[model samples]
Target: MSETQKSKPEIEAPQSPAPEALEIVDLVEGDGAEATPGATVDVHYLGVDYDSGEEFDSSWGRGQSIQFPLQGLIQGWQDGIPGMKVGGRRQLTVPPQLAYGPAGSGHPLGGKTLIFVIDLLGVK
Candidate 1:
């Protein structure tokens, strides 16, 4: 007896239009010190393409964290990250102007908006 195998269908991810302005949403406000400019911060972040909801980066999935000066990040991050305290979790919907700009990064992400959910672990 010869039988054919059945294949499951793949589901598409949700998409959103590019934001006109930066959107900041605080999921969990921490009780620690705020992340001021020039402060070194450790964070776990998930970055996705706003138009297609495609994941671009994630520190949590890597089972690791990143530490960098707050000012070193993009304008949206620099503006949004401040006031976020250690242990805080925030969602940032960044416009193209605040992200990689009209040129974007590369390929599919070009001239598109980006969304990032970041967790502030520590500040130094």
Candidate 2:
């Protein structure tokens, strides 16, 4: 496989202004289907607390990609994940409001800025 095919997701923190809103950066530009609103997407992901660098959740660890409609996810995901092509990878830095809000999403998240490395596996 080529480097683009085997490259691991890079861990990165967004430079200023990222904490204020949703920040998205593409890591791999895929050559397949594009994500649109209401499209069903199959993806692998890793979620972490930005400030603490602690992993909060991951689909990669579960060995399965999840399929979900774009409209059913969080605001940041809804706004950010779209335009990604199948087989693409993205790094998103989401502020609390776009994430779980003040109450957080339960243990390990705590309403802080979140960092996610998402692999767009497929789109239908």
Candidate 3:
């Protein structure tokens, strides 16, 4: 298998009708503060494929979210969490531009939109 095929994250397409607008349910909205590029944040996330509604990954099962530096994440995450606040929840409909682009990173995600329900629990 090629490297591209290995890094892509597996995600099914969304089956539900696309909402006209995104609904954000913030459990803890960060203080409207900007997070540093390499800042570490702990959050609970539910990810579903935009076209399939199939769950791709979730931190909720673990009973808690995980923490990692924004810079250490994929482009989608690096760009997505900066605006969130502690205790904030947001539904992010990530386009291919903001997510895994044309040539997927080679895990299971092959150039697809990712819908994420993110709950910002805290920042370290």
Candidate 4:
């Protein structure tokens, strides 16, 4: 983490009727390099269930950011994160099919829509 890093962000609960497809919204656009589909990204992110409005994961909660290969993440992330630049903040609303899949698929978050707020730190 850098000294310029922002503190953890707060995600508001979403209203009913999650979108049927992936939704990407840029909260803060960055001036740094843009991310490519094959890039490895370092980011701080929070994920919550759209229906429950309960946090399910967070890199900020761990007091550190995480670096992951884009291909290794869920389909929603893979589709949503590219084109985002380092230092940007983005929100993604992901339906079950793009998140973990429908209920009984065994991933816990399966069958649920998910909301993620991501702060991009670096891309390589």
Q: Estimate each model's TM-score.
A: 0.81, 0.84, 0.69, 0.94
- lDDT per residue (tens digit) for residues 1-124 in model 2: 2254344455655455446878888888877889998798988888877876777788867777789998888788998988999878888898888887765458344478899888888899
Segments of candidate 2 deviating more than 4 angstroms: 1-18, 103-110
Count of clashes, each model: 0, 0, 29, 0
* Stretches of model 4 off by over 4 angstroms after superposition: 1-5
Candidate 1 vs 4: which has more TM-score: 4
lDDT of 1 at 101: 66
- In model 4, where is the ten-residue run with the lowest total lDDT? 1-10
lDDT of 3: 0.64
What's model 4's TM-score? 0.94
Writing each residue's lDDT as its tens digit, candidate 1 over 1-124 gives: 0011011112134354556999998877777878987789888788887767778887766777889997888888998898898767788988888877677366455577788888787899
Ten contiguous residues with the weakest lDDT in model 1: 1-10
Best by TM-score: 4
Please give, for residues 1-124, the per-residue lDDT of candidate 4 as tens digits.
3333477767788776899999999988877889999999999999999988899999988998899999999999999999998888889999999999999999999999999999999999
Clashing pairs in 2: none
Q: Which sequence of candidate numbers ranks them by TM-score, best first?
A: 4, 2, 1, 3
RMSD list, candidates in order:
10.5, 2.6, 9.8, 1.8
Model 1, position 47: C-alpha lDDT score = 87
